[model samples]
Target chain A: MGTTGTDIRYLVIIGIAVMLLLFTSFLLALIFNQRKKLKYQQSMEKLREQQQNQLIEAAVRSEETERHRIAETLHDEVGAILSSAKLHLLGIKSDILDERDQQLHEKGRELLNEVIQKVRGISHNLHSNILKEFGLNEAIRHFIRKIAQGTVLHATTALDDNYKTENPDNDISIYRMVQELVNNILKYANATEFIVSSTHRGNELDMVIFHNGDGLTQEQFEELRYQKEGLGLKNIQNRIILLKGSIHFTSGSEGYRINIHIPVKSNQP
Target chain B: MKLINFIRDWSEVWALLIPLIIILVFKPAKKQLRPVILYVFAGFILNFLATFMVEYYYLMPSWTYTDGYVNNNILYNLHSFVRVLFLGWYIISVRQYKFPFLLKTLLIFYLVFVITNFTFYESPFILSTRLYAAESITLLVICLFYFFRSMQDESDINWLKHPSFLIAAGISLYEVITFFIFLFFYPLHQKDISFAAVTMRIYTITFVVFCILLALALYKSRKKSNLSGVTG
Candidate 1:
C-alpha cells in the first residue's frame, strides 16, 4: 500500500510536468501563428497606405494641373485674339479716318464682344454653377450625359438615396472620388461597359465600382501595388477614409472590382 | 418475430423522419432558394429514406437489451442520423468548394469502406449494434476532414464565419475520446491497461476544455464578421 502511494505521487508529478509542457507548446504555437498573421496584415496595410498616398498626391497635382490648363487657355487662345483685335483697331485709326473706316471700327467692336463671350464659356468650364445649384446627383447625371454622348465609353450610375455624409466637404470628395474611379476606367479598363453603384445604409455608404477589362493578374496586382504605387487609387481611398470610410480591391472572372464603405452620420440638406 | 416486426414497422419511419429533421434544420443553406434548392434537397431526401431502411429493416434491435444493446433509448438513434446528415452535407459542400485532392481521395476511400462494412464477417451479436456505430464514427472523421479542407478555401460564404469547421473540430475530438472508450470496453475488450488507460481517462477530462476553446473560437469568429463592412 505504501509503495502504491509513492507510485501515485510520482505519477501525479509526471502528469503535471507533462501538462505544463504541452500547454507551453500550444501557447507558443498560438503566439507564433498570431505573430505571423499580424505581420502579414501589417504588410498589406502598408501597401494600401502607400498606394493611397500616391493617389492623394496625384489628386492634388491634378487640381494644380487644372489651374495651369485654365491659365494656358486664357493666355494662349484669348490673349492672341485680343492682340489681333487691338492690331485691327490700331490699323483703322491710322489708315482710314472716313465713314468706311468707321464701319471697319464697328466690325472690331463686334469682334471684341465675341471674344468676351468666349471668356465667359471658359469660366463656365472651369467651375460649372450647375454643380452647386443642382446637387451631386443631378450634376453627375449631367456629367454622365455629356460624357456618354461625347465619349465612346458607356458609363452607368447606381445611387442609394439613404446614404448621406455628415461632412459637407464630402460632396467634393464624392465628386472627385467618382471622377477618379471613372477616370481609371476611362484610362485603364478596356472593356466598354462600366458600372458605379452607391448604397446608402444608415450611417454608412457602400460604393461598388465595377468594370470589364483586361485587368491585372493577382501577381501583377501585387507587383503593381508594390512597384507602380498608383496615386489615383490612394487619393480616392484617403478621401473616403476622411469621410470615415474603408476601401478594398479584388479581381476575379468579372474583372476588377472596387468596394468602398464610408461611415457617415447625416445627409446633405 | 412479433417484436422484430414491431421494430421493423416503425424503423422505416424513424429512419426517414430523423434524417429529414437533421437535414432540414441543421444542414447549412436549407433556407437558401435558388441554385442549391434541388441539388441539396434531393440528397437530403434520399439519405433520409436510406437511413429509414437501415434503421428498421436492416439494423433493428430484436434481441434483449439487458447486456449491451443500445444502453439508451430510440433518441440515441438520432446520433446515428446526425452522423449521416453531417457526412451527406460534407460531401455536397466539398463538391461545391472543390476540395483539395487529398480530401477528395479520403472521401472516396470512406465510401469504399462503408460498402465493405457489410461484407465483414461479424459475430451476429456485434452485427446489429456495433456495425452502425463503427460506420457512423468512421464517417464522422472523414466528414470532418472533408469539411475542414473545404473551409480552407471558402472565404466568400461568411454567414456563420466558418461555424462548420468549428463544429467539426468539436465533434471529431469528442468522438475520438468516445471511440477510445468503445475500443477499451467492447472492440478489443482490453480488460485493463495500467498506464495507457489512465492517460486516456485523463485525456477525456480535457474534452470539456477543448469544447470551451471551440466555443470561444466560434464566438470570436462571429464578432469578426461584425468588425468587417460587409453589406447584407
Candidate 2:
C-alpha cells in the first residue's frame, strides 16, 4: 500500500501541474479580451465626442448667420430712417427760430443720435466683424473696454506678442470660453480685480485668469462635476480637450484662479 | 504492500483504459479536440513520472518487485515530477477549456511543492500516498466547484447533483477512510495492518466507480452531439 501511495502521489503532482497551466492560459485570455473591449469602448467614446462637437459648431454657425441678418436690417432700414428724421428735424428747427423750441429740437436730435448709436452697438456685440479682422486680442480689448464702461470691472488683459498667429479655431473657442467665464465671474464671484493673461513658452501656451474675490466651496465644485447643468464649465472643458489642452481651476483664500494650457505647434493637426 | 500494488496497478489501468474505451465507443458532446490533445500529453507525462518516482527516486519502499530489485532511475523521478504538475492543471482546467495558458503553466510549476513530500523522500512518514490523493481531490474539488454550481443552456452540468461525478468522488472518500486507518494503526506495527487489504478496498472500489462514470459521461456526450447534428 505504501508503494502504491508513492505512485499516486506522483500522479497528483502531474494533476497539479496540468491545473496550473490551464489557469495561467485563462488569465492571459482575460487580459487580452479586456484590452480589446477597452479599445472598442474608447472608439465609441471618440465618436460621441465628434458628434457633440459637430452639434456645437452647427449652433455657432446658426447664431452667427442670425446675427448677420439682424445687423443688416438695422444698418439698412432703421439707420437710414433715423438719419432722415434727424435731418428733417434740424431743417424744421432752423425755420422756427424760437429759442426754447430750437433748444428742445436740438436736444431731441442729440437723443435720437444716441439711440441710433446704442442700437448699432447692440448689433455689433451680437456678432462683430472686428473680431475676424483684428484677431482675438484686439477683439477682446474692445469687448473688455465696452464691459468696463458699464461696470467697475477694470478688466485688464496681458496677451503675448504671438497672439495673432494662434490657431484661428482655438482663438475663437478661447474667446467664447473666456466670455462665458467672465460672465459667471461677474454674476457670482463678487470680485474686485479681473486680470487675464496669456503666456507662451516654446510651443506651449498658457492662459490664466485671476480674481481677488469670494471663492466657491468644495461642495460647489463637486456639484459642478456631478449634477448641475454647469454648461459653462462643461463647455470650457470640452473646448480645451478638443484643442488637446488642459484646464485647471483653484479656489484660494485670496480668490479663485483658472489656467488653461495648450501645446501650440505640435497640436496643430 | 504487494497486494496494494496489485490493486493500484489494476485501478490505473482501469482509469486510462475505460476512458479510452468510451471514446472509441461513443464520441464526446463537443468534438473536444483541444482537451483531447492536452489531456493526452498531460496524462502520459503524469503516468510516466508517477511510475518512475515510486519505482526509482523515492526512498525505495520495502515492497516486493518482479525480481526483488528496487529500480532507481533519474528519468523516473523527473518524469514523475512533471506528471504531478500536469495532473494539477488537468483537474483544474478539466471543468472549462477556457482557462488561460499562463495560469496552466504556473499551476504546473506550483505542483512541484507536492514532491517535497515524504512519499518521495527518504522516509514516508507525514506525506504519504494517502495524503497526496487527498490533496489532489481537494484541489480538484475546489477547481470544479464552479462547474457544479448551476446548469446552463450550453452546459447543463451540476457536479454535486450528478451521480456520475459522485462515483469519481468515491475515490476521494475511500482515500480518506484508508488515511484514517493508517494514522490509527501506523505507530503499532506496519505488518499488522494488511497493506494488501487497504489497497484492495481503496483502488478496486474507486477504479470501478471512476470507470463506470467515465463510460456514462462518454455515452451522454455522444448522444448529445448526435442530437445536435440531427437538429441542425
Question: Whose DockQ is greatest here?
Answer: 1
Q: Please give the CA lDDT of all the candidate structures.
A: 0.52, 0.57
Please give the clash total of every predicted structure, in order: 8, 46
lDDT of 2 by residue, B93-116 (tens): 455545455446545444554445
Error of 2 at B15 (Å): 38
State the lDDT of candidate 1 residue by residue for A1-269, as single tens digits. Answer: 33353354355446446545643454345445545655666787789877765666566557746855785677577767786776766666534568776786787777776776667545454543455576656556666665566567777888775544365455656666776767667777776877778877777667777888765443443344334467665455457555656666678886788787776665456
Task: Provide the DockQ value for model 2.
Answer: 0.02
The 10 consecutive residues of candidate 1 chain A with the worst lDDT sum are A1-10
| Superposed model 2: Cα runs more than 4 Å off | A1-6, A94-104, A150-152, A215-238, A263-269, B1-232
Candidate 2 clash figure, as a count: 46
Residue-by-residue lDDT tens digits, candidate 2, A57-154: 66655655787789878877787888888788767845557888778887898999997897777767666567788887787778777777767777
Clashing pairs in 1: A52-A234, A54-A231, A55-A231, A55-A232, A55-A235, A56-A235, A163-A200, B15-B52
For model 2 the local lDDT of residue B25 reads 67
Best by lDDT: 2
